[model samples]
Target: MIKRLICAAVFSGTIATNVNAEELRFTVWTGSKAHLDMLNDIANGFKQTHPDVTVRYDTIPFGDYVQKLTLQMAGGNPPDLGWLLENSAPAFVEAGALADVSKTLHATENYNYADFSTSAMGLWTKDDSVYGIPFSTSPFLVYYNKSLYDAAGLETPDQRATDGTWTWEQLKKDAATLRNADAGVWGYETVDGQGYSARVWHNLIPIIRAYGGNAWTDGTCHLDSPEAVKAIKLFHNMIYVDGSAVPPGEQGDFFSGKSALTVTQISRVSKLADANFDWGIAPLPAGPAGNAATVGQAAVVAFAQGKNKEIAAEFLAYMTSAKNVAKMAEFFPPARKSVLEGDAFLSSNPAITPAQMKIVAQGIENGSVLPSHEHFPQIEAKARPEFDALWSKDADIQATMTKLCQGIQPLL
Candidate 1:
């Protein structure tokens, strides 16, 4: 009986030791094997200091990330660390759902917090509290099929960009020429072909900005502004009138050689590793407002409800250090000023030419991030049906813009 009691004590001690060595749960939207491998490598580095802590990265779909994360928070199972999109930053911060990680960042040795650009850190900070660190500051660019341009007997977008002739009006004409229904070739495709619905704002913001408009400013909706309306009309004409761009319910993928052009970030060049056709990237065409580069940003945040909030903050600091930021720049553009302007960033991706990378580097330096609001998810929910109404022919451009503004105004 005495020996049994001693065994019981040993077992209890083992259980307690195991409980002390915790595994941190992290959530990310990417399911790609390559991406996960890189992330796991970074997580492995934590062992240098935290020998017993393990991090598990859970993959959440981009469209449902915020919704599902909120559910986890409600269930008291929130991840220790997660990737937050810019639009959700304000809502998350305002809800007190994210831990204030400024102290951890400030205390980290050799972290170099000031290396992050002032503009890049704007949305993640509120006065004295810092909630997150921006990981991706990717700017939108036009990826064009060089073969299609050659077949269409027209100069490529990069050529036009250099000649100062790459305007939205010129794109409309070029797209019309490149489109061939008989050949099953489309002139343009929006981000992943979900633009009209799941990615409505992502699809239109670049053109809207190029035309000198924004979703809102100072608590007012601007979708109905003259510039915004004009920009939407041009895209409408491409889908319905010119029949160049792939419209709602249709599919045309540029990487598959079925589409001539697409507007996304440089990271997507990974999709062209085995391309059968030639491709090149160029800055988004200029509009009446001149060159208006647009960026989409995501950040690393530690949840306020995490079981190990302090440890999560320490890991966040390590992952966003200049060294790790440069490592991640191969897939996700870094927001660090030192990395963004360095030669390492220029040659980070083997798939892209140095000149093409220059376009990306320039856009990061001179672009505006997509519009973000505290109530963005609510605004998107309300604006859904209104935006759907614009996909049809004979859709009154001015009237639709007014209705869209009306739908999202209350949420604004």
Candidate 2:
């Protein structure tokens, strides 16, 4: 009888262990084969440590990611883990749709909240509490075609890094010198639209900060200042007055080898690598504020509505780990110190060396994130028309910004 009881207890324990080892489902909105392969490798590694646990990965097209994710959440079934951009987190968080991982995230010894870029962490924090682990983050960088600079007899921006001489004024002057109309190449081309508008914002904010204009104060809009007006005027000048940039409508032509320089995110490096021109990346131009800052975007967050909260959190933790993060960093730069300093990340990408990565790291540390206000989308919608008008020289800068801010104020 005693032997039978012991055997029964052991059998039940084994069954419980098997039950605990079930597969977890994960969903991501955007990634490449290399990204998915790295995720699979991380899952395999996780399985090795916890033999009973399995991970299932799913991907959604970037175009329909939000709509599909919303439908899935409404359908009473959601993945164990998923991706969330920082600017888009408030709506879901306000709806009480994300699992609170404050306790789990804080309790982990390897997790250092301070190690993440402030912009990345700000997206997940609400009322002084953190809700997500940032997986990927990037700051805007100024990429120049080295060959163009050499041909123009213009000095490289990188050479000015130590002296802090690479200011916006200098960039504008250099761009003018490099412009070649006969060859159909302009000094620069950057879009001002829904997503690409970020590039404009990234370039503008530093100027605003330099001019001592603040975007917000204690969650309130403070963009209606003289300094802000000056910054906007500078942008208008870039597009219409100085003609440094291709006109808004003809901007696409620039990407087709018609622009001598472009200021965009580091991610564009991969695409530009295949371009017929020789190019190199550099930090953004300095502003009057005595500092250069870039806007960091695209942070990963876990949804509150996920079915397998615990398992999803575990997967998120694994995804942010040094090894896995380093792999992901090959595509999207890592947001943590461990991965940033790890050999895997430091040695993986030959295109961006550790030194170049350090410049990006510094940018994130000193930069800011787009605010997560409920009215942000509304503000963006209203501002677009005004910005377009200003860029086209159809309206005065001050009047346009004033009207733009007024239109967005009611929504806020």
Candidate 3:
């Protein structure tokens, strides 16, 4: 009776009634009031079809997320649905921790499952089974301080992106020109200041990819390739030679106006909402191989251990439908091709204009998700000390990369 009612309501796009009530627990890492508010709105909308169902969102700090979630699953108290990072996807899917939602997704009426991009869906799928749905397929972009650019008497990234001169070399020159020792302002900040450690891969992949270097291909390591070494050398020069990037221990926040540029996703735009200076978003600088856009993705998954697995998958389908994905484009960039190319997504956020949003759309159309492996955590642990070795003034770029690759190749 419940299944028939759900199918009927979903097909008719109307409300269904049930005397028995159920609540789903969904875990996520974001604690932002705005993000929660938007999420709550979506959750409430789900009651239109499943009138007796309720969704409760649990917030976990990012650093402790995977650990706590693993504990919950081990303790036999896993969330019905949860948001899983790209790096964790392979591990979770391999362990059979996630429920297969392909049947539920395909069974939902008017779902238009094909609207999601193939690249965006790559991580959650394995042959005949689908374990999750990507919720955020955000791309790396250059966020520039337009006010600082104007004060420095230099063109901003957006202007250069328009003129076809926004290459990595040009960015390096701009960073050098904008460095202001007297005011204590830095030229560039990498991926939220954790680039050298926690976000080391995110810090290097775009630059490496733009230079035609890849982390690995078909089980072979390429971090020591000539293209990769050159890319690392350029960044190394920026830190020690140019003294432009905020170094390993230093503090410089682009959103706080202490840095002139940053590489981040559209979600960070909320940080600039009340900024004291003008800002704009632009595509990542190009390289010899042209621009190689990189994306960071997160997916919504149902746990295999959940008591409410079927209903959880139904709600997942509801939340990620084309209409809701369009609504979510304001904060979480959508993976749906229909929403991404639509005019509504361009104007979804009041803080960003349509023109600026187009850069994000183009990036989604071309970008590849950041590197992920089943052994990512082990690889990150083994590669940390090697990465730390390269932060010094006279670190040998070629030798360090060669050593780093040797250590991680086995883990891969």
Candidate 1 structure quality by residue, lDDT tens digits, 1-412:
2122222332332211222327878899888776888889999988788987889999998777777777666644668899998888887777667789999999999899999878899989998899999989998899999998997789999999999999888888888899989989999898877789767888899899889888899999999999999999999999988999998888899999988988888767778888999999999999999999888899999977677888889899989999888888888888999998999888998888888889998888888989988777678777888898898898987898899898888877
Candidate 3: stretches off by over 4 Å = 1-21
Off by over 4 Å in 2: 1-40, 47-80, 103-120, 126-130, 191-200, 251-256, 341-348, 410-412
lDDT tens per residue, model 2, 1-412: 2122222332332211222237676777645565677778889988886687888777987545655665655544555667776555665555555667766666666766577756556667787665677776766677777888888777888777667788777877777787777777888766322223434455566567766676666655556678888766666676667777676556434345677766666655555545776777677777666665655556455555554567667767766766676777776767787676666765566677777777777776676664556445456556667666666565577777677777767756
User: Which candidate would rank higher by lDDT, 2 or 3?
Assistant: 3
Candidate whose TM-score is highest: 1
Sort by lDDT, top down from the best: 3, 1, 2
Hey, what RMSD does candidate 1 come out at? 8.2
User: In model 1, where is the ten-residue run with the lowest total lDDT?
Assistant: 10-19
**What lDDT does model 1 reach?**
0.85
